[model samples]
Target chain A: MKKYLYIIKTTFNDSIQYISSLFIRFIGFAITMSILLSLWTFIYQDNTTISGYTLKEMFWYLLLTETITFGSKSPVATNEVKNCIKSGNIAYQINKPYHYIIYSITKYFADTLIRFIAFTIISTILGLIYVGPINNISIISFISCIPVFLLAVLITGMIKILISLTSFWVEDSQPFQMIYSKIILIFGIFFPIEMFPKIIGNILRYTPIYSVSYGPAKLMLSYNFSFFLNILITQIITIIIISIIINIVYRRGVRKLNVNGG
Target chain B: MLTEVKNNLKIMFLSLKYNLIRVMENRVSFLTSVSMMIFNNASFIIQWLTIFTLVEYIGSYTLNDIMLFWAISSGSYGLANILFNGANKIPEYIENGKLDAYLVMPKNVLCHVITSSTEPSAWGDLIYGYIALIIFNFSIKNIFLYSLLIIIGALIYTSFVIICNSFTFYFIRFSETSEILKDIFINGSIYPDVIFNRAIKIIFFTLIPCALASWVPVHLIIEFNIYHFILLILATNILIIIAFFLFYQGLKRYTSSNLMEARS
Candidate 1:
């Protein structure tokens, strides 16, 4: 735990040096959100509500979704795992005090937290400027959303690690990364599952991506105690399942590495 | 000048051929990348679908018009990336002094640099673009016009990227800024032109020139106007000329990194 803390602290410090680049990324996100806002505003130029969401609500919803999608990016773990496998650096890490998986997760968490905070602040300011306050979000709901958002970040990190570990066999994990991100972008980040066709929405709810992206955003948009509980339970289950899969895959990959004299 | 043009075209074709063969060596990776790009692009259709579901048309653009918008945008993006991908990497090349190889080559340095690489996933975009066009208008005339428009759009897109990237020579560590500019141009191109106000519209036409890449081309395709077509061609050529001038002007200031590196 202490070692993990140290890793987090160091990663956080490292991220600060790239603050200008992060600001540039924030500008990119702002431009994207502004585009969405214009598109939605134009769509609602005629009528008031569409499928129970006001134009303001829709804008706010998009803001939250964009926040989750951009904020929870966990490239560090993916790259780290890929490099370790490619360069046989995993052999060196295997002898370290901390578990390799734990170290990777700590680094991912620290980097993601720095990005998430920066993005959230930027998005909020942009939202306030563009659409004003949402007016429906309660303080309680926002507070309750914190833990679930952290869990969502963790789930995303774990999934990235799993994808990265595939580099042990595959020549490149970039395609898998692209596909997974697209799924999240389409089904989870772009719209609430409820807005999807009923059957498709229900099916997506069963997938882990739902918990990773939509769960926290949905809670913040309009919180219900039962809804919160359900998503929380789903997130926990996903984390456990993915963790087990990672452990199995990492162990097998290490064994294969040994056989190959890596 | 004609001889130089013919020579550059020949070299560009050869570069593209070798790049294709290189990427195809990893068959699964290549196929996966292309398919994923297509799938990713397809997802945007759903967002528009949801919008149209709520309203029949937004700002004189029906669902069909929106589809045409995407077709042109994706098709132009594909054309630019497939043939001239190095525009995106100009900053890195300048920063690391990787342009030494191109400078030593006999061909036009800018043309050689841009054609030196190709993005396989852009083929997916090209395929998706044609699919959208077929779904919308499959006539022989439309096909011919689509080809011409894609060329015009690609030239503008490539020149815009080059112009953005040439800033690297003027300022140290401006790569991120270049990326942000490219992102804005791309994100702006994907949407309908009606969404932008007059000020932004002006910026899109002049500073970023994103309108030349997709929106103006889509308009020309939908309703053929010889005047607009002529204007578009003139603007694209002027932009390309400006890009070439800026690149060469910046080249004079470039100091080689003196680091030894090999190209595979």
Candidate 2:
């Protein structure tokens, strides 16, 4: 447990370095938020609400989506796997002491932290201007929900790595990575899976992405202990399944690899 | 001169063929781009349908007028994208030191970059635009006017994108400029010109000049505004001149850094 904590601390430091180095990226993100928030505010000015979401609720939802999105390792995880395979770095990884998956998980955490800070500052300012303070949720819920959100992030990361490992067989994994991440963003970040078609909704109900964004967003809004437990159980089960699949694919990819470094 | 024109046409066709072949060779990137287009067009149709359902009409233009506006906007988007996708990413090329490849190429550097990226997503918009045009059943006069408007509109936007992209040579961070340009062209141009009164309309026409991109052209086609018809020709020439000057200025500032260093 202490080792894991140390690993996390080190990773967090690395993420800070990354954010400082690529400072322009944060500025770009801030501008993107302003554009989106202003556009939503404009639309909301005409129609007070859409569905059940008030202008305030809509703003909060946007903030929530943008804030949590910084934590999405779904793309980076895939990119790491694809680059590793393409450059034959997977062989070097075999000799390393740390697990390859741990490296991806930690990097994602660091990336998310920087994104979260930028988002918090930007959203806080925009939210104040547009709709005022976010909903008054309980402190208990806020504190308790942290783990669930982290669990959600982990699930997203695992799923991305799983999709990325496909590149070990195929020459290029970008198409699969793009389609996978889009599915997660559109379904997970933008719209709740419940709003999707009945067939897709049912199929995705069992997926890890459900635990990542939808389940957490719902929990943040309305907390039912039973529903929370169900989400937690779902994430655990998905993680186990994905881990098994990764191990199988990793071995197969190792055999198929030409071991030629670019 | 005629033979030169024919040769240029042949080269353009060959370039298009080469572009398709290059994209096809990298199947993943092509598929991702096409999918992005599908997603974009789908969302656009849904959003427009929602807005149209709510509003009756603005100005003399009715729902059909708005649909024609939609079609023209969509067509301009596709045409400009096909023509100027490379110019769009000039900042990145300049910043990341990737512009060297184009600068060294014997043919026109701007042409190489502009033709380098063919967004499959714009193709979806192109199809949708034609559909919208046919559905609106524009009058003969309106059709002729709208066709001319579309050409001018594409030129205005193409020049704007080129000019914005050239700014990357001076400013290291230009993604913001492109983002702002996108907002102006994509979302800003959609509303009827009548939404703004005369003064604001004039500003949109002559200064920031978004109306030349869509609103003025579409409005003139339907309402037969003589001033705008004349303004379109003037706007086209001004935009072309601006683009040429900006590109020339940016090219002059460009230090011929080695390709390897540029990649870094």
Candidate 3:
């Protein structure tokens, strides 16, 4: 655990210099999100409620959804690979002591930390001044739920790595990356998966992505012990499955790499 | 000037052809990107449709008016996406010293840079926007006039984007500027110009020129305003000329050190 913390801290320190640009982006993100949410708020003004929730509840739903969604890091594995491929720079990395996936995971950890801080700052400011606190979850639940949320981020990054590795076999990985990211955005963004159509939503609820997004969100916003436990179990199993698949793909990718030329 | 224009047009087509071939080489990636773009645009259309179903209009515009506006805005957006996405990466290229290769090319350095990274996905957005326009309640009576106006609108929008990208010469670091420009187009142009007061409308039309991209053309197309159409065409020509001049001027200032260090 100490070694892991040291690695994470080193990664975070390396990325801290780039945090200023993210601050600018976060401001723009906050303003746009606020306006979009406020529009929904206005639209729901005439109605008493939507799907058995009040306007404030709906606003909270949008805010919390936006927060968690923003917390989700950009899928950068494909991008990193593309840059390496374009510049023929992967050879240098292949010789490095650390594994590629571990390096990527570290980078994403640093990236996600930046995202979390930027988003937390933005949301906290907005929540204090413009809107109020979202929900009143118990302190114990809030504290305990942090690790589950971090695990969710880990799975998300792993999923990105798996998709990016497909670039090894495929000609262009960007489109796939864009599509998968969009899926993450839509299903994970404005509303929880449960708010989706009943049958599809129920299925999505059991999936790894649901645990990554909705589970953590619900735990933070509203304490649901049973749902949380179910999500934890599902996440553990899903991680194993995803890890096996990733390992297989990674080996194949290394075999197929045009390392000699580029 | 006429010969230069013809040569540039030829180069543009050649570059576009080359890009198309390169993109097609990566079939799966190209198709996936295209499909995702189509889906993204379709999602917007559906959202607009749901809103229209719930409400008669956003402000004074009817459902048809709103759809028409979205159609023009989205289509212009598609053209802009194709043309300037490469230029948008200027910062990265400059910082990474990738601009070196383009500078060594025989053809126009700017054109080469712009053509190297065409987003084939934009075609999906273009198709969706066009389909929306065709399905909308607009009369088919002025099809030729509307088509001409939209073409001019696309040209003007493309020119403005070129000008925005040329700012890499002076600003050098333009992340904030680019973000603000994107926000201006995305938020300001989606709705009708009339929704804004006359002052803001004038500002959008003249300063930002987003009105030419969507609002002015859509309005003139619907109302059959010959004067607005003529004005839009004239503005398009002027903007294109200015864009070309500024691009060349900026190119002159693009020194080795700037190319090496600038983040654009």
Top candidate by lDDT: 1
Quick one: best TM-score, which candidate?
A: 1
lDDT (Cα, tens digit) per residue for candidate 1, span A113-225: 98888888998899899988876778888889989988888888889899999988887887788878877877887677777878988899899867887787777777899
Pairs of residues clashing in candidate 1: none
Residue range B61-162, candidate 2, lDDT tens digits: 666777777777777877777655676777777777787887775555666666566656676566666667776754667666666677777778777788
For every model shown, what is its TM-score relative to the native structure? 0.94, 0.75, 0.76
Regions of candidate 3 where Cα sits further than 4 Å from its true position: A1-6, A54-56, A74-76, A81-103, A135-145, A224-237, A251-262, B1-33, B43-70, B81-118, B134-146, B187-211, B216-231, B234-264
Give the lowest summed-lDDT range of ten residues in model 2 chain A. Answer: A20-29
Restricted to chain B, the TM-score per model reads 0.97, 0.81, 0.84
What tens digits encode model 1's per-residue C-alpha lDDT throughout B1-264?
999899999999999899889989988878888888888888788788866766778789887788888888889999999999988889989998899888878889998889888898998998898888888767788779988998888899999989989989999888888888888888888889998888888999999998888889888878999999999999999999999999999999998888677876
Which is superior by lDDT, 2 or 3?
3
Among these predictions, the greatest DockQ belongs to: 1
What's the DockQ of model 2?
Answer: 0.12
Q: Number of clashes in every candidate structure? A: 0, 1, 1
* DockQ for every prediction shown: 0.67, 0.12, 0.19
**Candidate achieving higher lDDT, 1 or 3:** 1
| Cα lDDT, model 3, residue B152 | 72
Tens digits of per-residue lDDT for model 3, A1-262:
4544666788677667777767666766665565555555555646675555555555555555566557655545557765664454756776776776677776777667767666766766765565566567677886777677677777877887788777777666666667666666666655555456678678887677676777776666667778778778878888899889988987887777776662
Candidate 3 residue lDDT tens string, B118-172: 7778777677667777777445664565566666766776677677767777775
